[model samples]
Target: MLAADAVRVVAFAGLAAMIVAGRASLPLIIVVAVVETAAGTLFGTTEHAVLRGIVPAEQLPDAVARNEARGYGVSLVGPPLGGLLFGIAHTLPFVANVFSYLGSMIGVALIRRPMRPAREATPEKYGAALAEGVRFVAGEPFLRAVLFIAAPLNFAINGVIFTIVVSLQRHGTAPAVIGLTETVIGVGGLIGAFAAPMMQRRWRPATLTRLICLVATALLLLSAVLMTGVAAAVPIAVTLFLAPACNAALFGRLAATTPDRLQGRVLSVIFLAAGSASAAAPLLAGLLTTVWSGTATMLIFAAAVAVSAVVATVSHGLRQPAPELTTTRQAP
Candidate 1:
């Protein structure tokens, strides 16, 4: 609840300040980018908390899959809407985003659950609480192994975000065309998100997770290995489709395993782990490409993700019941 309010306030203030200041500038863009990253990280943490509190143990996976679908559904709307508005005017799309954010504030006002108190430790015990959260996460064999795979994969692929955009521009794709390409990937993700529950019903989350990883990895390898013409775009686009669905399942697993009373702490810890990856991505990506050609770098990243695949394949963690899956209090 607080996080939601903070988003509206920060965004509104930034928008208002930018508008009043007259010219939109690089400084403003950098600030907004920072805020945007923070907002997404915080929102993810909030969603994890909500799932821990509201969803029952058995329903958590389906619940998270549905939430993932809903997010992509929003993406289906937001990206196209932004693209359509961008066609009208660049500044207009941002102004339009402002209105959508305002609508969110109105929706938040309508929420009935009174905001709860600090969800983890007391003020004085924060350090100990933080340590406890870290220790708890370490104790979870499943999560630990998953991260071993995911962290390096995250580390490797993050560079592609910029590298791909740069590669696209180097190939002379227009800005609008890049947006169109993104929309294509978004379409693929929209399809995958809806299909996740059906997929999960038929296959275990771990199995499903592996399948998406394979699809993404194969695509990555293809793009890097082929590196010939516009055809390279196809495989990267395929990778885009698989990433979010896999992430949704991975997070669903995490939410199921975290305790409600410690949900905020645990989720925050997870956010920190992810944020560290993102924080390092650009620098690492730049350093990597400097050491090797872009295509070689991409292939290297593909291989790194393959390491994650192997970890996921071998870890017995994926098959076991989540240790803290239920809402029960810990035994004294």
Candidate 2:
């Protein structure tokens, strides 16, 4: 996500720079988008490598969760900070974002971790290592269990409709209102993240996610009541919190399940699925907005959350009570 975010940030930055310099073009915009996406993909691959390498086998899940929490925190803070930087100089955000990639690369290089290196390859084995890892994740019980919740949670509930900002704007809401609404949502996630360790003491991470999923689902269902301004804002804000909370738990599970040797590959596969869903949902959302009732759109997202909960609940493998790893630094 950090990497993918940078792509978006740089694309915007590059575009802003062009606009500020009065040298913008359609082609340039496209190029920026392409570069950003490519970098993000690479970052995803490398990031998993770093985490999987560094963390001990028993500690992968919690590490993944903590990472996700930090990510959510960043999401919570970044937009406002980006806006502040942009306010100072049109090019500042993008220029600063480009350097972010460099910093990430530097960090990755400096980090020491125990990663499974590619086996000695025969001529026929060029990409076999990658393929092997993908297949392993595809079959792994714990990792697969996460997809049951994480994939739909992201694709349907989170990705199925316009972003909250877009949704508000579509309803002719103002920026100040959007900012306040967003802040409320971020606060929820932040609170959830801070409480995660303790939350795990009582409930499995998956259990926590299930609870969050239900609340978030209820919130979305309520959002269908959004014929008026009040109905629309609260659910969306709640989702922001719910989504991050669920994500934090899910990442923790993923890390726990992934073998140290295959962390990079497993993480990459997970990210790839996310990227694909992200690529797919906007088109679907646009299509739905054109013909589907607002109630229908809300229902679609609600169903996604419901189904994820069901999957987590019934998956004989995942439904087993979650085990909280009390030893936090078992990996680092």
Candidate 3:
């Protein structure tokens, strides 16, 4: 992960230099974008795995909530800072990102504890190791339900968000207004992160997950009907306000239920499933908006969320308390 961060720092520096020199080519830009994305993914996965390893099971929820809050805090600051830097110079933001990556790398390097899990008794083939993670998640009903509901929920939320941004742009809304909407949503997320530990203490993970899904469904439906930027933003803010608590409970449960050795692969699979859905959402939203209108696109997104809510409501897997990890099977 530190190596990935170093690579990102170099890539950002290169991009900044190219922008300053007016020599940025399409291919170069594409390459840098791809590299940065890969590096960021590696960094994120490693960060989560390390957190799981370093924090005790009893404290995992609060630890994860704090991490979530810090990310929301960054979201609150990063956009305005980026815009300000961009106004000063087009390359300035990239230059700042280079330093950001370097700082992250330094922090990672400063960690003193061992990150790798204790070595297993028997070595496992790479494909078999990957397959084990798949089997583990598939065998767990609660995790399976989470995997199922999260994918569509992610897709719906991303589609609606992209649709709103594009619709606002098409309707000649000021960029500052659109940015303000995002800032409002970020504030809500920050509040959610701070409240997550308390919520976890008050409710079971399954219960919290169900409530969040139901509320999100209603909010999305409201956004679909209202269609105005403020109306859409209000629901988005409320939904984000509940999101961190949901995530802390869900992820903390997963961390407790999976063996340390499988943490990286299991988390990777969970994220990949949801990310795959999100990756296609912007294009899907754009197509729907082009064919109909933003209102129609939002309704479609709401329908998707509604389906997820129904599934969560009915799934026996999600209704029960998550099972604890019983044994660490050696790789065979």
Candidate 4:
């Protein structure tokens, strides 16, 4: 994590310098973007591994919830702050991000706990090590179901969000109002994060999974029905309200069941699975909007969400209870 932060500090600082010197180009921008994304992904995966090590197995749910809350809180403020900084100076936002990574590096340096248990040395080939993680996830029914549900679910949800933004922009809605709508929706996620640990404790995993799916499906459909930003905002807010708890619940189980040695690889695989569909969402949404209309695109995405919900609700793996968190963590 510390190394990842250092990389980001260098990457962002270089980009900011380029912008200030009027040396920024399309290729330079793309390279910087890739470096930053890779560094962020490394930091995130390591952070999860560190959290699992720092917290006891039984308390992983609350730990994950707190982390989710922090992310939600950042989402609420980051865009507005970045935009404002950009308005003041084109390079200001990148400069600010550079400092943020420096701060993160300092914080990581202060952590005293070992991030993983000591294990016997066993060197393996890169491909074999990677395949081990993939095989583990593939063999685990619950984890397999998570990948199955998350792929389409993320695609649909992201598509819906992109469509909403495009629709609002095309309609000539004031920028401030659009930002406010996003803020309101982010608030819902923040509140949901605060409530996640309790929800996990009270609800069975299967029940919670079904509730999240059904509610999201219903609310997404409602958002599609009402095409206006303000009208869609209500349902979008409600839909996001369930997300943090769902993530905490799912990730908590993942942390509990995955071995310490495999944490990074396992998480990488899961993240890739979860994010792969979402990567294409914006382009697909744009194409759909161009071909038909924003409203029609939304309806199509809503239908996709509905299909994912049905699949998730009925999946045998998801219906089964989550693995119990024993005193000793699961072995690799």
Model 3 Cα lDDT, one tens digit per residue, 1-332: 88999999999899999998899899998999999999888778777776765666677778889999999999899988998999999999999999998888788888776665677889788889788989989998878988988998889887888888888888888988988877777788899999999999998877887888899888887887767665677797788888888888888888877778888888788888999999999999999998999998988888888877888888888777666634332322
> Each prediction's Cα lDDT score?
0.67, 0.65, 0.84, 0.83
lDDT for model 3 comes to: 0.84
Best by TM-score: 4
Positional deviation of residue 137's Cα in model 2 after best superposition, in angstroms: 2.8
lDDT of 1 by residue, 120-224 (tens): 354538798788788877888777766676776676556665555556666687887666655665666677777766666676667866775666678877777
Rate residue 324 of model 4 by lDDT.
71
Mark the 10 consecutive residues where model 3 has the least summed lDDT. Answer: 323-332
**What TM-score does each of the candidates earn?**
0.82, 0.79, 0.93, 0.93
- Once all C-alphas are superposed, what RMSD does model 2 give against the true structure? 4.2
* lDDT value, residue 203 of candidate 3: 88
Residue 309 lDDT, candidate 1, scale 0-100: 81
The candidate, 2 or 4, that scores higher on lDDT is: 4
* Pairs clashing within candidate 4: none
**Looking at model 1, which ten-residue stretch has the lowest summed lDDT?**
113-122
| Deviation (Å) of 108 in candidate 3 | 1.2
lDDT of 1 at 87: 81
Model 2, which residues run further than 4 Å from truth? 1-21, 56-62, 112-127, 160-167, 239-245, 320-332
Model 1 stretches with alpha carbons more than 4 Å out: 21-24, 73-80, 83-91, 113-124, 322-332
**TM-score winner, 1 or 4:** 4
